[model samples]
Target: MEEHEKDLEDVPDMNKKNSIIESGEAMDQLITIDGEERITSHNEFEPVPLTNNLNADELDPETTAKLRGDAIGDTLYSQSFVLKTLLKFADLNWNQQFEEDLCFLWDMTAEKSVCEYLWELSFPSVACGAVAKYTENRFIEIVIGTLANVLCVGCDKTMTKEEIGVIIQELDSDDHLVLIQVMRFISSVAFSSSETPFIDEEAMNRLCFVLNNSINTELLLKTLETTAKLTVDFKLDKNLVNSSLYNAVLTAYCTLLGSAYLELDTKDGILACRYMLENVTNICGYIDRFENATLKLDITENLDGFLQEAIKIIKYLSQEENLLPVTDDTIFFMSAFQYIFINLNVNYSPEIFIAISKILYIVSEIRNEVERLFESTLELECFLISRSTKQRIFKDLKLLSKHKRKTVLDVVLENGPKFHFAFDLKDLKDEVT
Candidate 1:
């Protein structure tokens, strides 16, 4: 067992990607991306003090150095004992000791040196087995979390193709918590670590199912993050070419905004408010909440970015669209264009008004240079109409009222479509410009 928790810098950025904890209080977000102090991601819990609790006897100092543990693992023998104990309890599922060991492993794996040593020791094999064998919600969540921390510490070129197949096979699930962690795992580990991510058809289908149908906001957010990870991190567009996936991204704004019917799973059904920033905020603020801020934040950036990347991939791969300008009528882009134009007339509520802005921003992104589809000038502006909140998350969104670049607000106003305002968006002015 290590005597120290890592400084935040020592912590793996894997868990920090495209997600924010649900910090239950509602505080005003004030931002000026250029001038504002850096907005720390947590309005929620502080980062965990990452350290393992195991204090077992060392296997041997000689053996530890042979396994590249000399610097980080002067105490590698203690880790060996922890690993052996973890295997012993793998099939035991959710026993208290097994859970404790799993948490320790997850904490230990957060350090890259420890993670690499454990990988060489076949901890990843142990983890994948547990991921398949564990049925209880708690164990499945922790083990998947551990596996993600292990595999995704850096670009994961070390993992074999077979290991990814096992995880991809296990992704079909009815539990939101299990699904959420697994989605995070895939996005963080499989996509970043692999030269070419190996997703089986079943896993891809399950992901599409989650994306197209699920109402669970946390799960949906994670699923969207997975799409972003594939497109952004791996640069793998073939994985995202599913028609269902494209349609899901297109109609996602409608589903999340409550502008369309969503299928519910009885196991963890959600009300319409689950996807709304305001509703989720109100509900999650109740006691300790585990809501995903992804829908409000991550999806804000990923959704459009994913689509734009997919389009670029399609053009580059097919070598056909470069000859013809990609347009609203182009076969590949029709899904996104259709979703945007069709939903243009739908009225949106203020707290969730960001949904419309998101979709409209998507349209503006695709139609223009497609330069920064995921630029997210509007992400910080989400769920806010306050003059102060506007300046805090400062991006080009502040100039929307003045119709800068003919921003989203400009399009909505000029179209004369029904829109709900939390406040006068025109007042969300950037004084500097």
Candidate 2:
């Protein structure tokens, strides 16, 4: 990245077709759909001259994938100017004007054609090169954000598997913004490819690197998301990840629960916790898919410590004050501790939700309750008559997730709208980070 100065500096100015932006007159044809103007906001910046251009060798492994289609008609911009600015971003001297230009690049690259054209111009090396250089946070965020937009391709965007590997493996995990963008890049790589382990083995290790090291909530969640995407519902490929990933994910959950600096009682903390828990559950299932006794044993050993940490999180979340309301479930939380009417089998426990999506998703009313029911969850594990005497409420929602959530409309169709139901996961762990 930092070492690619010569490759970047030596770009000897592209041809006039790409070089000249028509500030004087826009492209003659206007883009239209059904004869109506297709309006879009364009970030305008005064065009600047680029000193150099890429050699033929620098544009090797050119990508022809087109996620964007549609001419840049009447847009008043040039592909060459966009490409040159991005390549030279790291080399430019600091100024408000340049920052404004970078912001414009950020907005311009969102168009698929721009992303496609940039990829053709060997964008991977240019983008990854900047990531390698130690730079300011805002620069890292903009460039990486732009690169992530480019990488979010409908077709193969891998310029070179090795170069892609370099981009992921070399990111700065300590920088929260950098880690977040890299996570998006990782996610794009996972989804864009058709293969299991979506990224190359070497690049996959970078996920563990970020998971094991990053404390940023968003980055952790994003990295976990990418990792979850790469996992198969059945068995996992031995090469997808090594033993260290489990250790890293489990430790991340522990760190998250124990983080004194974060306001864990906040809604965002609760959401982060819920996502991480789900991812951890998925990882465990993935590990269980391993037929190799030794590997299974190793992962099971790792889970012991994580289970302890998880218990602590559960305990922390179990308190009455820690839980928030979906406008307060069943018009009462355990009917304000008076009575909880719930169904259970002989083995009903926290682990039961994993087998069936024991999700108790309900709203206090008619429509939203049914909407959340079909949209997010399964059976009602809690349904009962209410008695408003208590000095309290059970708030222990973990028990409600034992059965598939029923549609409130369906239930109301049978039992009427007055029917009361309460739902919550016994430590919700379904969707991944």
The prediction achieving the highest TM-score against the true structure is 2
Candidate 1 stretches greater than 4 Å from native: 1-77, 89-93, 155-157, 193-197, 233-240, 259-433
lDDT of 1 by residue, 265-369 (tens): 111112221222211122222211223343223333434433343333223322323323443222323233223222222122232333334444554546455
Best candidate per lDDT, number? Answer: 2
**Candidates' lDDT values, in order?**
0.43, 0.44
Per-residue C-alpha lDDT of model 2 across residues 346-366, encoded as one tens digit per residue:
122243222122222233233
TM-score, candidate 2, is 0.52
RMSD of each: 16.8, 15.3
- Tell me the deviation in Å of residue 225 in model 2: 2.7
Q: Each candidate's TM vs. the true structure?
A: 0.46, 0.52
Report the Cα lDDT for residue 135, model 1: 63
**True-structure RMSD for candidate 1:** 16.8
Give the CA lDDT, 0 to 100, for residue 326 in model 1. 40
- Clashing residue pair totals per candidate (backbone < 3 A): 8, 14
